[model samples]
Target: MATKTWKIEKDLCRCCHGEGAFNNLAEPRTFLDKVEVYSDMLRECLDIDIPPVPGELCAITYTICNACIARLRDACNFKKQVQDCEQRFMTLYYKNAIQGLKPATKVKEEIEVSIEHAQSDTDADIVLKKEDEDDDDDNHFLGGDDDDGMSDDDLPIKPPKQSVSTMKTRPKPKPKPKAPPVVKKLKPPPKPKKAEPKPAKEKKGEEKEEFTLTVGADGKERFTCKACGKSFNLKPLFTQHYRHVHLKLRPKLRSCHLCNEKVLPWLRPFHMEECHGLPAPSCGACGRKFAFPGQVARHQKFFHMGESAHSCEPCDLKFKSRSEYNHHLIKHGDVKAYKCELCDKMYKWKRGLRMHMLVHNNIRRHVCHVCQEAFFQQSSLKYHQMKKHPETV
Candidate 1:
């Protein structure tokens, strides 16, 4: 079925109307949809484009011809005679200022920190090697190829043993009677296994959440916002309140006051160009003056060149310092990230999480020396022992 539609007005379709304003004979050809019919109407009349009315279908009935358009251009600014005259006499003089277009260029800033921490791992490696050597010595005598090359010819051979016939000759005279076979009475093969139905599995209980230790004192903590006089009851509340109130001031607040406008205090240290302004420390590596002397040296070492001194031997990744190297190791994804998915306990490894879960569940494994009572994690065990058996550390 074709979608139903109506025209704008009778006067708009004067060409199709004869007896009636909306002639049934002049009705638009039906299509599956109205979009195609509307498109045809738009192309039939070209006044730039057919204007549309809200909540109604459109019917194009007007068009601009090339001849009429040429007449309008003749009566307007675009005149061919005026253009020919200007071309023949060069009426408009060209200026040198109008430079042609060119490709654009951009400069990108890049700061890289090259850290090296591979050396600290050497001591542990040496200790592990020594431990392996000791274990090898105890388990197997791994002698050199020189000792292994010795053949049986290197050892003295022993003579063949003589038979002890004199003492047991009496028993050999008569062969002992053969013992009867202790045959097992035949039993029918077990009833062709009535497919031992698998025992239904019982799922373990769901894990619990970790115990969060709140650090507020006296069940209340006073927090004063630096920007305004807002005080919050809890630290978390204070943090949220601070962010809400002082978010705008954070960019303005990090400055140490001693340095003036020369120092932007943002990531980039802007220098105050005045000579009378206080002196700024220049970075040793890049010779860039920062607002602060210590900050300048740190930036020079860490951003300009090889700043990391410690690194992992296994993966040549570097760190700015020992602490940074330790933090970087977390990215390798091998060691324990220390997060207890079950109870929200953090550990360096899965094993640590397991141990921590046992603690939360109060799985006592260690025994006290004095009271003989067991406790969970070693720390608790030690604490119990100290309380009960003080001397048995």
Candidate 2:
């Protein structure tokens, strides 16, 4: 057997900073410690994308591909690289938020009034010219009849005063088009002097509030890490990050019931029932419950167990049960598997990555698909819905 040598940088792991990791040493004698250790290592170290929240501890994997990892540690500044990526992320996020703004486009009431006035003035000029021509013709026909009827100076001079209704109903004239004045070409502004590009250097770790990532023998990586003194395997993570997200692997559970042994959810169901006081699962489709663990086995044999009725048409995926089918389909679309090797920021799906992108890009476009809430990830969308509007589900 090739003995694997393990070294956790003493600077990396510490019991303090109030962080702990669970270990699934090759064979854990106690199930309680076994479950915690396995979950912690996977969540915290091997896949440090998502770290534990206030009351939680992240999962860490006890596997690392030695050759690939050694290659990684050798090639680049792991800490600086992940941190720089995060800062760039926040900057980009701010820019997106700036872009999502709507501009105002409106025609002013003053412009409307000016157009109406111009039309009316043109119409008045045409009417006045016609009236003056009629008067001139009358003067020509009644020439030199001053003494026979009345002196020309004394002749009745009646002014045609328009009535209130006539003035109000008068048709306005078409306004003349004025030539648009030539537009002055704007002068180009002076170009800004280009600043010299600064040489890349690792940031002083103390300057910002930092999230730490601790790497282990297993290929998986995690945060909230202390140097693991215990010698462990250096197996690289074969677990696909997208498919096996951390919390999903943990039982959909409340506080654990067993004291002596932590509930090993990953353990074969039959083994759980035999070894621990696990309640036999009743079929949701048919309310028929079972007594030992052998019931599902018998049902599979008798019922349409071999034939899969539950299936997704899009992916041509089928499952024995509906729940299995649903869970499988969730994996088909763009899923979030983003883990910040920087701050231990973990998103449930790609949108989570996008939202993280927004935090860097400063994009906040993730409005609520449901109510007053908006989120960066689908998991967040689901969480808000569950918490605020449970009935909506």
Candidate 3:
């Protein structure tokens, strides 16, 4: 009997069992030497512990997708927040309990200190009043002999001073007389000046450029502009040149009635739905709405009308639209017409080249609604949703 070999699938998420771009948990370089380990976080948040397997059994990829990683982070943050809140609550509870059990002796001491301060303030005020009365009495006895034509030795002996409960009140000074107010006559307002007449503006007539059409020997008509002396073979080209170059007018644009914004004819549909909150154009046959008019027309012709205008002989495939048929033909011929400007990468279809160019830029337009993970391509976002969040799809 021949030995059989089995192929083990590795591109799967350990948490959600989905496949897409995944981050390796076993590799340290993939985590950028972060302190928090993926396995530890999973165990902490979801209580899902991964066993430590030896390097010999490393054939399986211990990886997690972007969506799963986002979920894990949210779970970890929630757990940390709950733990912190519990710790804070317990600390506050203990503090309040300790404060409630404080001794009543400290409260009694605080009341006694406040009463002493009030008593001290009253006593100090009474002492200051007595000192002021004594100083006034001594000054009154000494002031009388200064103008009495008597020396200090010839002065009569001072009598004993009687103690007064309060000091003598000082006399109030008289108020000065007020001056009379002066009045003056007011001047009349100045007269208004006469207005001057403005000069009349010159009116210039509009210059009309006449275009003459001439038939060539080969029966091809040519248009010649008289203003700039430019010639064009087509009538539309001549009209466009005359309007832009001679009249200085741009091409006519349609203005949105709701927003009053001018937009090109081709981009009007997109602007209406995106800006004005209008519904996309729907098909009358199936009542199915499409983002663009081209999609609605294709849907009506392919499904409703059962149109298959283009067919492939080699593959026996039929496509309703010519563009789709051309795209199908490129696979058979292996002809790559679209080339990347930044890097010389080639693609068979223009859309393939457009999606490939996103690798050169950092733009992630498609985003997951569940975990809010962004992707460069819409297909990648769809795949992530199908794997990680099947319920949302």
Candidate 4:
């Protein structure tokens, strides 16, 4: 007996039946919901209604495609433009009709006669008023009495005016001259004090030896460090310990030719190319280029020399490249360096972390051309197309 496999069905657009991109109609506060609420707008503009599915109720998956939404927006905008033009035209027509009105025949003659008489009276009154003002001004200047017989002594007395030559103007005072600045001789700086010499202390013993070699009971040569009093079985280990701990010596660093920045000998080429825009080094054997000198050397060793330099001792597995060896070592170690900030999920590789981040964002960038189905990744899209539309492949 064969086991039955179950599959989930995808939601299709009600109008187009294509599932590339869509907006859920059942969701509230969404674009499709607003279109449903104002269904008459579509009818008045485009003369169309919402497409309905027989024997099925609109659910969360029931949606309208982007194409239909765009058409609806264009129709609504056109309808609004036509309405605005009609309103503007009617307003201008009424204003012109009021402004173009004609006066009554009986009022026209009376209005013209009244305007002419008013203009002639205003001109005569202006001339007489100017003559009267001139006569009053002349009488005032000649010291003539008023018609009321008021004497000049009883009127307000005015201050006497002075002639230009008769007026006394005070002269401005002159500014006092400034004195020259005084200069004093500065005293010479005092001499610096001489420091007293400190007495030298006596040495305890002749300088301590760095290391000493001895023969152990097991017949193995032992290397001992006199400074730290530590022993090592191997000479290489003893030398490395003395150099690192006692001497405090680090690896020799090289400066970049372009930037003058000091870096480790192994990292100098990479630093120069990445930061200073220099070309990467190429493999002399195969003429293949790489971002760093180390990669070129590794490539030469692995491909040209056919050597497997990296190996796992526990699993006894060997890999031709450093990257493959590192990847194989991940199974043995429980180290997770990459982590997702959204859900606090950890992954062994950066690619795994990036792929997991898509779940939090929920963005579908890859779409199947045959079925118009959308997916978050290209691999998923390929799988969907292969299963649903094999003929298209």
The candidate scoring highest on lDDT is 3
lDDT of 1 at 6: 57
In model 2, which regions exceed 4 Å deviation? 1-180, 183-226, 233-253, 256-278, 282-304, 308-393
Model 4 steric clash pairs: none
Runs of candidate 1 exceeding 4 Å displacement: 1-275, 284-287, 305-307, 341-393
lDDT (tens digit, per residue) of candidate 3 on 1-393? 999974545566777767666776533222332334575577557867554344643335567778877777788889999999999889776445323343333222222121211224455568667777987998787744567677777868796564442324342343344344444444554454444544665332233336886654333457888887888998788877877776777667866655669987556656857995544567788788665555666687678877778989999888976899987888899778999988899888888886786677655667776787878777898999999999989
lDDT of 4 by residue, 128-242 (tens): 6776787689767765577789977788978746444334444334434434544455555555445454577644332235678665433345778888889999877877787
Q: Is candidate 2 or candidate 3 better by TM-score?
A: 3
CA lDDT, candidate 4, residue 313? 95
Model 4 regions more than 4 Å off: 1-300, 314-324
The total of clashing pairs for model 4 equals 0
TM-scores for all candidates? 0.21, 0.19, 0.22, 0.24
lDDT of 2 by residue, 267-316 (tens): 43334357644434444456564542245444544464555678788888
How would you order the candidates by lDDT, starting with the best? Answer: 3, 4, 1, 2
Per-model C-alpha lDDT, please? 0.47, 0.45, 0.66, 0.62
Assess candidate 2 and give its lDDT. 0.45
Worst 10 residues of 1 by lDDT: 206-215
Candidates ranked, most accurate by TM-score first:
4, 3, 1, 2
